[model samples]
Target chain A: MATAGTADSGSTVPTGTSSIRRMAPAEMPGSSSTTQSMKKTIGHRGVETTTGETTYKKTTSSALKGAIQLGIAHTVGSLSQKAERDVLMQDFVVVESIFFPSEGSNLTPAHHYSDFRFKTYAPIAFRYFREMFGIRPDDYLYSLCNEPLIELSNPGASGSIFYVSSDDEFIIKTVQHKEAEFLQKLLPGYFMNINQNKRTLLPKFYGLYCVQAGGKNIRIVVMNNLLPRIVPMHLKYDLKGSTYKRRASLKEREKAVPTYKDLDFIQDLPEGLLLEADNFNALCKTIQRDCLLLQSFKIMDYSLLMGIHNLDQASRERERGGAASGDRVVLEGPVTPDQRRPQAQKSLYCTAMESIQGGR
Target chain B: MATAGTADSGSTVPTGTSSIRRMAPAEMPGSSSTTQSMKKTIGHRGVETTTGETTYKKTTSSALKGAIQLGIAHTVGSLSQKAERDVLMQDFVVVESIFFPSEGSNLTPAHHYSDFRFKTYAPIAFRYFREMFGIRPDDYLYSLCNEPLIELSNPGASGSIFYVSSDDEFIIKTVQHKEAEFLQKLLPGYFMNINQNKRTLLPKFYGLYCVQAGGKNIRIVVMNNLLPRIVPMHLKYDLKGSTYKRRASLKEREKAVPTYKDLDFIQDLPEGLLLEADNFNALCKTIQRDCLLLQSFKIMDYSLLMGIHNLDQASRERERGGAASGDRVVLEGPVTPDQRRPQAQKSLYCTAMESIQGGR
Candidate 1:
C-alpha cells in the first residue's frame, strides 16, 4: 500500500527523499505478531517505497522460496508431461494443477493448470510447442530458482513489480489480485488463439501462480523475458503504433539503455526498423496476423517491443580497449544450437529476437 | 476396361483357361498411338489377366515413371513444403500445388491441379499435420520411384492396381479418376480432422500425385502400406462395421493370407481381437473420436483394416526348418538403430504402427 504522502504524489519520488518512518509493532494498528521480525514496514524490501522500486533481496528464506517456486513449476511441467504420449485423450481431459497446504508448511494454496495458466491452449498444443520448439522441462525448472533472481523495478507504476531470472531467460511478473481471475476467464479464447495459429509472436507464458505474501495473495506470471541476456541490445524501442503520449519521460530517457517510444523512434529513425527484405516481409506478415488475432479477442494498447544490437557500436567499443569486452559485446546470432549446449534454453521469444540485425 | 467376355462373369477366371485373345487397335476406338508399344490390351503384366493377378516387371521406363511420379510427389510435397520452417505464417497462408505443361515434355496436355487432381485442403491444417506429425519431404520423395517400384495386384478388381515401393514402405494407390476429385473436395474436412486430433489411427497420407500412365491421367495417393512387407502378418481382416454383403469371395479366401471380413472374424474368433487392457482402451478412445470426425464428414462404408501376426506360429515355422526363413518373420520392431544406417527413412506411419501392439 502507498504511504500517506506518496499516495497523493502524481510522480514517483527518488530514493532517500521520502519521509519513511519505522513504526513499532505496539504502535501499528492491526499488526500481526509475526510482523515483529518484518523490518521497516514503511519502505522495506518487497515493500514498495516512494521511489517506485520494490527490491527483492536474497535472504536465507530464499531456499524456502525456491521450493515454493518449484512446486508451481513442477505443477505446470506435469500439465504437459505426457502430452506427446497421449494427444487424443488430452483433448477432453481437464487436469488441474493444484497445491494444498503441506503438513507443517506455512505456504498457502495455489493452482496452475495447462490451458488456464500455461503456454499453448491444450496439452496437445503444449506438446506441439515442446516437440517443435524444443522447450524441455529442465529449462523451466532450472531458470525458476537458479542462483540469484534479478529484481527489476517498474519505472513509472507504483506497486508494480517483476523479477528476471539470473540468466535473464524468464520473467516472473506480479499481477493484480483480480488479474489472475481475469486471465482464467480468458483461458478459452487464449487457447483457441494458440490452437488456430501455430505461429504467433505473442508472449509464451509458462505458468501462473498465486503466492501468499504478507497475508495477501499475489498473482505471478512466468514468461520468457522479451530482452534476452545472451545477446545484449544497444538500443530498444516499444512502438505502440501511435504518436500521442508515447514519448518516454526525461528521467526514463536519462537511463543508460532506455526504451524509446513510437514518437522517439519515428523522430530518430524515420525509415522504420530496417530488416532484410525477406525478414521484413515475414515479420510484417506475422505482425499482421497476430494483430488480427488480438483484434478478434478485442485486445488493445499492446506495443511492439523492438531491441536493436548495433554491431558497429560493439566494434567501436572493442577498439577503445574496453574492459570485459568479451562479455559485453559478444555478437552472436539468436539461434543457439541447443544440441551442443544442454543448458541452452529454447523459447518462442528467440524467434521474435531473431529479427534483430547484427551488422546493419 | 474389362473385356466384354470377361465383363459378364461375376467371378475372376483362372489365367491359363481364358481365351487370352488380344483385341486389335483397329477394333478399339480413340486408343492413343502410345498404345502401340504397350502390348496385350486384354491382359499383361501390370494389366490384369482374367485371373485378376498382374505381375510387376521392372522396365527401363522406370526412370520416366519416376519423373512423372515426382511431378505429383513434388506437387504434394510443395503443399507442405513451408510447413516445417514457417509454422507461424502458414496458419493464414493458402498455397496451391499445381503441375502444368512444360515445353518439350513427352507427357501431353498437363492439367493436374485442384480438387479434380491434387491434395491440399486448408494449407494451415496440412501445415499443422506436417508440423505436429513430423511429416517430412524425404518421406514422399524417396517412397515414389525410389527403387524398382513393386507392382501389387488388386484381388477380384480387374483394372484396379497399386504398387508398393521396392522397400515395401509405401503404397502408391491408383485412385479412381473421379475419386481423387472427391477426396480433393473433402480435403478441408480431412485436414481439420487431422489438425483437431493428432492421435487418429487412420491411414497417414504423405502425398497425392497424378501421373500420365497408359495414355491417361492416373491419380495416385501415397499412403503408408497398412500391410507393410517388413513385418508380415499371418492373418489379416478387412472389417467393415456392417454385416450385409461383407463376406470375402471364395477366390479371395483361397489366398495364402486372405483378408477376412467382419462375419469371418466373428465366426472364427468370437472372443474378438485380444489386446492389453490399456491398448484396447486407448485404441477404442481413438477409434471413437476418429469415427465422430468421419461421421461429421458424412463419410460411410469405411473399414478398419486389421493385421495380426501370431508370434507362436512363427516359432512353430522356425522349428519346422522352413527354407528362406531369414526373409520372413522379422519379429523385431521396425525402429532399427538408424545411426548404423544413415539412409533409414523416418515417417509418421511408423509411429502409427508403434501403437499397434502395446502388449498381447
Candidate 2:
C-alpha cells in the first residue's frame, strides 16, 4: 500500500507534477502507491480493479472523493441540518475523521461468510496479535462482530487497547481466566500430571484473566479459547450448471453463477480413516492424552488397546496386548463394520478433507 | 485442607480395622469440602480425604510408610529411598491418568509445584470429563513421541483411573515420519511463526516425515500442532523454602524445627502478597492465566521500579472507568511529585499499601 513503493523513505514529488503518482500533503500529510495501469471508466475512488490490470491514480483527494461518493446525499443532508453556523460543525469533524482519510488497510475485507465479510490481518497463528490485547477471547472486539456493522479504521495490535461490546455495553479486554476456574484449572495441571506424557484427553490450560476497556469496564473469559473442532463432514468434486462454461465475459460470469443448491451431501464416512503413519501417530497421541485425562479425571480404564506405540509391542508382548504405532498406544474401540457403519456414520464423522469438500 | 470435624458416614474405620479399610478400597471415597473450596484439589488418580478432626492411621507396607513415620525406619537409607520411590511412582502413574478423583485433601509439599497427591478415588463433573477428552489440547502432548503410554483404570462416577506402567521396556508412544525433509516444515514460514506458547514453545512448523526409534523403527512429531497460544512461563510461582514443608506430623509439629534455609537472597513478601482474591480480576486476563506459566517459563516482565499490574493499561482504564468489585487496576508509568511521600516504605514498586505513611 505504500505509494512511492519506497514511501517510508520519504521521497518527494516534483513540485508541478500533475500525474497519478503522489507527494505528501502539506496540511494533512498523506499519500501513497503509483497506480500505473491503463484507465478506462474510473469510479469515485480510483479505477475499479475488475480486470487484472493496475490503474494509474493521483493520490491527493482520491480517498476523499471515494468517501464522498458513498455519502454524497447524506453529507448534503447534514449540511442543511446543522444548528449553528459560526462554530465548526460536528458533521465536519465526523466526515474528516473517518471518511476523508481512507488510508488504513486493516479495514479491507478479504473473504465472505454467511451474511458477513471477513478481514483477516493475517492467517490465524499461534500467539496472534489479538492475544497481546488485555482482553479475554470471549470479550475480543471481533468474536461475534460483523465486519460491515462496525466503523473500524484500524486493526489494533495484540496489546493495543481496543473497545469491545459484551452484553450490549462497550467494554475493554484486560485478562484471561481459564486456569482460575474450578473446572478449568486442570487445563494446565494435567500437563505436569504425567511423565513421558504420550496422549492426554484434557484440554490444556491456555490462560485466564480479566480485561478493562472503553474507559472503565472489565470483562472476563476462560481461554485457550477452544477453536472449532472440525470432524470432516463431507466432500465431492463439483462440476455442474454453468460451471462447464469457459471464456465467459464478466457479465456472463456473474449471471451464470453455480449455487449451493446444486451440490450433494454425504450421509456418512467410512471406517479406519488411518492413512499415513503420521496420522496414526497423531491419533495415538490423542488417545494416550485422552486416556491419561480419563484416568486422572476418573472416567476411563487403562487399555492396552490404547497403546500409543505398538509395532514393537505387537511382536513382543503379542499375547498380552493389542495395537501400537511405535511405542505409542491407541484405544481399539469396536470396529464398526459395513453393517455398523450406517449407525455410526449417523453420528456424522468424516475425514478432514471430505469435510472440507466445498467446505461442507 | 479444611479444618472440619469428621462425621461417621458409615465409612470411617475404627483403629484396629485399618486393614479392612484398605481391603475396602474406596470406602470413604473423596471428602466433600474440596468441591466447595475455592481451589478444588483434582488428581489423575483417586485420593482419600479427611475433613474434620481426623483420626490418624498408618498403612503397613505403604512405600510412604517410612517417610510417614520417620522414626520407625529399619534402615533409614533403604526405607526412605523406598518411600520416595513409591510416592514418586504412584504419583507419576496417578498424574499420568486422565481424571481427578475426588480424594483426600492435598498432602502436597509446598515446595513442589504440584498441589494434589495421588492417594484414593473421588467424584468429578462427567460432561466436562467427556468434552475435555473430546476437545483435548494439543499443547499437553507432543507428536515426536515414539509410543503411546497406556492407561489401566477409570474411576467412573467413583473416580480414579487404573492404569499400568512398568520399568520394563514397553513402548509408550509411536511416530512415523513422512520423510526426513518433513522436519524442515516444522519452522514458521517467512511470514508465519510459532512464538512462545503455554508449557512449550510452539515449534516453528517445518515439514512432516518419519524418525527411527527403539532398534529399527518409526517415530514422528507433527510440527506446528499448536493449540491456542499459551504462555506457559506465567504459571510458575516461587515461594520461600520454608513453605516446602510436608503436612507437619503431630510430633514434628510439636518439635517445630525449621528445615528449610531462610532466603537471604529474598525477603519476606509484604502483606499484599497475602491478599488473596478468589479470582485475580485486577490483573489482565492473559497475565493471570499465565500466572503459573510465567513462573514456569521464567518469562518475567516486571522491572525493579514497576509492579506486575502497572503495565496493564486496560486494568487502569477499567479502574478509572469502574465496573465491579475491589479489583481496581493500578496505573503504571510516570507520576507527579504529589504521588510520592517522604515517610514511605515501598512494596514491589509503588503499591499504595507500600507507603508507610498515608498521604492526602
Candidate 3:
C-alpha cells in the first residue's frame, strides 16, 4: 500500500546551488529543462552560495554511498523476520521505502549519511534467492559494507556506473528504471529456474536497492562477481553467437584487457575451445535452457561473459616475479598449500562463465 | 517439532585426555562419577595421549569461543526470514539447534571453531524482543562477534562466567540449566511486561544460547551492559533491599571498585539518594511494576544493579592526566562534541539502574 513518494516527507535537505549545477544541461544528458525546474520547485528554500561546488559534490557523493550501504545493511538485516516460505506473486510488486531525514533525533541518530530516500523491491523474493545462492546475511554485509567499494570504469554504452566490492566477491551495477522493472517481473521464473537447477549460469542477484538523493534516483543491483579473484584472467570475451556488429570497437580493442567478441574469438582460436564430452554437453544444455527462458520473456541482446585462465601463462608470469601488466594479482600473502593445489591441478585452458546479462 | 538432540549427531570432537582432566573432582565440583563415565563410554575411541594438556585446552577453548560466535551470528542473521507477527504461544517451546562437526565440508566449511552443538531457545520471541529494545540485528552481530569479548571476573557466587562486548554495549553471562529453563518459562509474562511498560528496569535479555562442547552444556544469556561506556562510574552497588547478611565481605571491600552491598550503601550515603519529585515518582512506579511482575512469577532474590558517576571526581581524575586505576576509561582519542554534551549536562550526582535480575 506504500507507493513510492506517498509517505510524508520525513525531512528534506535544502537543494542549495548544487541543484543548479546538477541541472546544467551539458552535465546531465537527456534531462529536460521542465524536469529540472520541477525538481527545483519541490523543496527549494533558497540558494546556498556559501558552500563551494567541490564541497557540495563531495558531501552528496559520500551521503549517497552511505545511504546505499545503510539501506542494504538494514534490508538484509531484517530478512530473517519474514517467513521461510515461497515468495508470492504479489511480492514482485512490493516495494519497501524508508526516508531518512538529515536532522536525526534520539530514536534515529544522524549517521554518516545525509537526507536520502531508500527503496527495496521484492525483498522477500530477493531474500529467498540470496539464501538459495548460499549467501548469508552477515557475510553479504561484511563483504559489501565493511570497506568502501572500488569504483570500476563503466565499459558499457548505456553509461551506467559500476562498483566492485572491496573483497572482490560482488558487483554493484547501476541500472535504468526500466531494467529494474524488467528484473522484478522476471523474479518468479528466475527463482524457479534456480530452484530447479543449481548449475544454471545466470547472474546471481543478491539484492536490488534504489537510493534517491539530490533529486536523482540511483538504482543498483548487487550480484555475484562471476570471475574468481584468485585466478588471473589471460583472456576475456563476450560471446553473443551473432556475427552482425558483434565485434569489439577499435577503441575497445586498444584497451589492455578488451572484451573480444564472436569475430575475435573465431579468429584467435580457429579450433575453438576443447572440453571433455561430458562438460561440453553440460555446458550446451545449460546455455540452451537459459536462452530458452530469456527468449520466453522476450529478452534479447544478452551475452555470455567469459574469462579464460591460461595455466602456462600464469606460471610464466609468476616466474617473472609477478603478474603481467594489466593482470590483477589479488592475493597478498604467501600462497598456502590449499591455494597452491588449485594452481597446480589446473589444465592448460580453464574457461569460466562469469555471468549472463542483457545489453552485454 | 525438532526436539533437542533428536536429529542426527552431525559430528563431534574427540574428547581425548582433556575429558579426563575435566573429570577431576576438584575442578568440577558436584559432577558425579556416573556422569563422567557415561560421557566417556558414549564416544570413547581412544585416549589422545600425544596431545599435551595445554595444547588440548587451548584448542577446546578457541573452538568453544568460535562456536559461540558462529552460533550467535547464524541465529541472529536468520531472524529476519521469520514472519513479522506477534509471537505465538508455541514459540516459547520452540528450540533450534545446529551441530558443527570437527570436519567440515563444502556446504559447511571449517571456520575458526571446531565441533560443537548450539541450541537457541524461542528464537522468534527473542528476535521480537530485541527489535522492541531498539537493537538492530546487524548492530547486534557487530557488537557481539566483530571482535573477541572481554572476559570479566565473575562477582557472583553462582559460578556464572561473564563476558563484556568489546564495545561495552552488551554483557554475555553464562547461566545454569535451571536458570535457562526458568527464563524460558517466564518468557510470556516477561514479554508482556516489557511490551506494556517500556521503562521497565528488568534485565534486557537479547539472546539465550546453549553451547554443548567437551561433554558439557554451557548456557549463556546476552543482556545490556547497563552502564554507560562513555562516562566512568565512580561508585557501584548491588541492592537487594534486604538487611540479613546483606553486607560486603572483608575481602570484597578490599578490592578497588568493589560492588558495595545494601549495608555498604547505607553506610556510604546516610541520607540516601536525593532525586527530583517527578523523577522519584517515575522511578518508584517503574520499580514497583517490575517487582510485581517478578513476584507474580514467584521469582525472588532479585537485586537492583546501580552505578553512580561523580562529576567532581571525574574532573579531578582528568586533571591528574587520566582516570584513576580503578576506573575504566573506554573512550580513546579526543572526545566529540556530541559525547561531551552529556558530561556537561550531567548533574553532580548521577544514578543509573543498570539492570534488575533474579539471583543477582
Candidate 4:
C-alpha cells in the first residue's frame, strides 16, 4: 500500500530496507488520537477521509489537474493566436504570468479548487518547438486536460511527481526551481539543436509551467512519453554510463515496473544490446550529437531510459494464456497478436534521455 | 415566437410590418413536409429537436459558444503570456489564425460542433486595449464562456446578431466583413484615444474575432455592455442626430425595451433631457471631444445609445406590488430598496456610442 505523504513529501525510506523493517507499527505516524482528530477535520470539511494518505493524494491530484488544465488551456490557446517566429534573447527571459483569483467573474469562472499562479516561460519559443515536433495546439490541450492524467510511480530520488497523459503520449513531471530555470536558459540552444537535427534523441520539451498554489511553487515540464503504451516491456533500465552509486535498491526492484539502474543493467545484460549495423551506426551518431550539445550547455547526470520488449518472452506468455510475470505494459491500444510467431527474433528497444540536470 | 432561420439568415421583414402580416400562414416556411424531413434529420442525428427555429438557434449558439470559448481561451491565454508593449504599425496588420479540426486529439478534444477557423486581429494591440479597459483575462473568459450567452433580439436593419454575456458585462455582436476591417484599421487610433482619456463614451472594443464555419465567415466583436443589467431603464433611444428616417417603427415601439430614435425624442420629450448645469456641461464636452475624434477618422452614422432610469416611476411600481409593465430590467444584482423612495426625483442617464460605421 502507498504511504500517506510519501509521494510528494520527499520523506526518504532507507535503501535496501526490508518491507517488515519499513513497516514497523511503532514507527507509523497514525496514532488513534491523530486519526480521531483527522476524522473530525474531515467531518468539518464535509468530505470523506478514509486515510491521511488518500486525502493527501486526492488533494494533490486534483490540484495538479486543475493547474495543468488551466495552464495548458491558456498556453495552447495563446500559441494558436500568435504567429510563428524566431526565438529572441528577450523571449528566453520573458515570463508570462497570470493569477487565477479565487473570486472569479462570469468570464473567468471561479474554480472551487485553490487559487493558483501560472507562469509560462518563453511561450513563443515553446510554440515553435511544439510545431516542429508535429504537436497540434488542440491535441496538446486535449491530451493534458481532456481527462484526468494517470499518476505514475516516481522512481527518482528527487521526489518528483509524475503524471502520464490519458493517451500515454505525454508525461508531466514536477521539477525543482533550479531545473526549471536551467530549462528556460537551455531553450535557445535546444531549439537550435532540434532544428539542425530532427532525429536527435533529446527529450522533446513541449511546455514549462510554474504553478504556485498553497504558497508552494510547483514547476512542471511536459515532455513526450517515450515508451509505447501498448508494448509489453520485459525489462527497463536507467543507464547513466556511470558505475558509482548507479544501482537499483532492493525496495526499488520490488515494484511491478522497476526501472533498474546502470549496475543492474551491467549484471543482467552482460553481452549488451545487439543492434543491426546500420541501426547501430545511426543510434551512435545521434547520441554523440546529443551529448555534444548537452556538454556545451554543461548539462550532466542525464540517463537514457531504455525499455526492452522481449519478443520471445512475450510470445511464450501469450501462449500461456496471455499473462506475463512482472510485466506492466499498459494495454492501451490493440496488442500485436503476431508477437506469438516463433520466427520473431529481435527485441524492440526504446531509449529516451531523461532528467538533464545542470552540472556544477 | 422567433421564426426559423430569421436570426442568422439576414432575411428582412419589411419595416413597420405588423405582427398579423408577419404571421400570415401562407408566407410561413414551415410546411408539413419540411417539418417531417427536418424531424427525420434530427432523429438521424439522435438529438432532440422540437422546432426548426430552436434547432437553428441551438446550432448557431453552440457554434458561437465553441468558437468564442476557444478563441477567448487562446486570446486571453496569449495575452497573459505576453508583455505589455506599444502598439506597433505591424500590430494593426497581423492576424493570428488557428484551425480547430473536427477530428481533435486528447489535448485538443474534438467537439461535436462544426469545425471552425478562428482568426484574431492585432492580438497585442487588443491585449493592451483590454488591459487599459481594466478587463482581467480570467474575468473576460468566464463572462463569455462560463454559460451560454443570452441572445438579444436584433433591432438593427443591417441584420446583425447580438449576444449579451451571462454577467451582462459584455455585448458580442456579429459585424459585417467591412466593419471588421474598419475596426482593425481603427485599432491604433482607438488604442491612443482610450489611453488619452479613460472615461470616453466611445464603444469599448475588447476582442475582434472571425469564425469561419459552414463556408460562411461570421465576424464578431466583443465590447463592453454599456447598459447595466440591474438598472430599470424606463426609456431608451438611439439618436444619430439625423431626422431623416430617424423614428422608431410601430413594431419597434411594441417591444419591451424599445430603442427610440431622434424623431421620437423630439415628439415625446420636446423639452429634452433635463440635467443639472454641471452634469450637462460635462456630458456636452465629452460628446464634443468624442465627435471631433470620430470626424477626424471620417467615421459616420454612429449613434448615442442612451438609457433613462426613471426613479419616480420605479418607486410607483414598487408601491403597486412591484410589477412594472414593459420594464426589462434584468434581476441580476440585489435591488436597491432605496429606489422605493418617492422623494428620489432625479433620473439616472446612461449613454454609450453604438455601431461606429466608417464613412466611404
Candidate 2 residue-wise lDDT, A69-133, digit = tens = 22222222333354311111111112111122123234322221111111111112101222322
Candidate 2 yields a Cα-based lDDT of 0.22
What docking tier does model 3 reach? Answer: incorrect
Candidate 4 lDDT score relative to the true structure: 0.57
Query: Which has the higher lDDT value, candidate number 2 or candidate number 3?
Result: 3
Q: Each candidate's DockQ score against the native complex?
A: 0.03, 0.01, 0.01, 0.01
Candidate 3 Cα errors over 4 Å, as ranges: A1-360, B1-60, B81-83, B105-107, B325-360
Chain A vs. native, model 3, TM-score: 0.74
Where model 2 places Cα greater than 4 Å from the true spot, the runs are A1-140, A143-233, A236-271, A291-360, B1-360
Local distance difference test scores for all models: 0.47, 0.22, 0.56, 0.57
Model 2's CAPRI class is: incorrect
Clashing pairs in 1: A199-B88
Candidate number achieving the greatest DockQ relative to the actual structure:
1
Interface C-alpha root-mean-square deviation of candidate 2: 22.6
Kept native contacts, as fractions per model, are 0.00, 0.00, 0.00, 0.00
Error of 4 at B327 (Å): 10
Off by over 4 Å in 4: A1-360, B1-51, B54-59, B325-360
Q: How much is B171 displaced in model 3, in angstroms?
A: 1.4
Residue B83 Cα positional deviation in candidate 1, in Å, after optimal superposition: 18
lDDT (tens digit, per residue) of candidate 2 on B51-123: 3211111111121211221211111222224311101112322211121112312322222111112211111
- Chain B TM-score of all predictions, in order? 0.66, 0.17, 0.74, 0.73
Per-residue lDDT of model 3, residues A261-358, tens digit only: 77898899889887667656666666776666656566554666566666667667777766473455533222233342334222111223221211
TM-score of chain B of 1: 0.66
TM-score of chain A of 1: 0.67
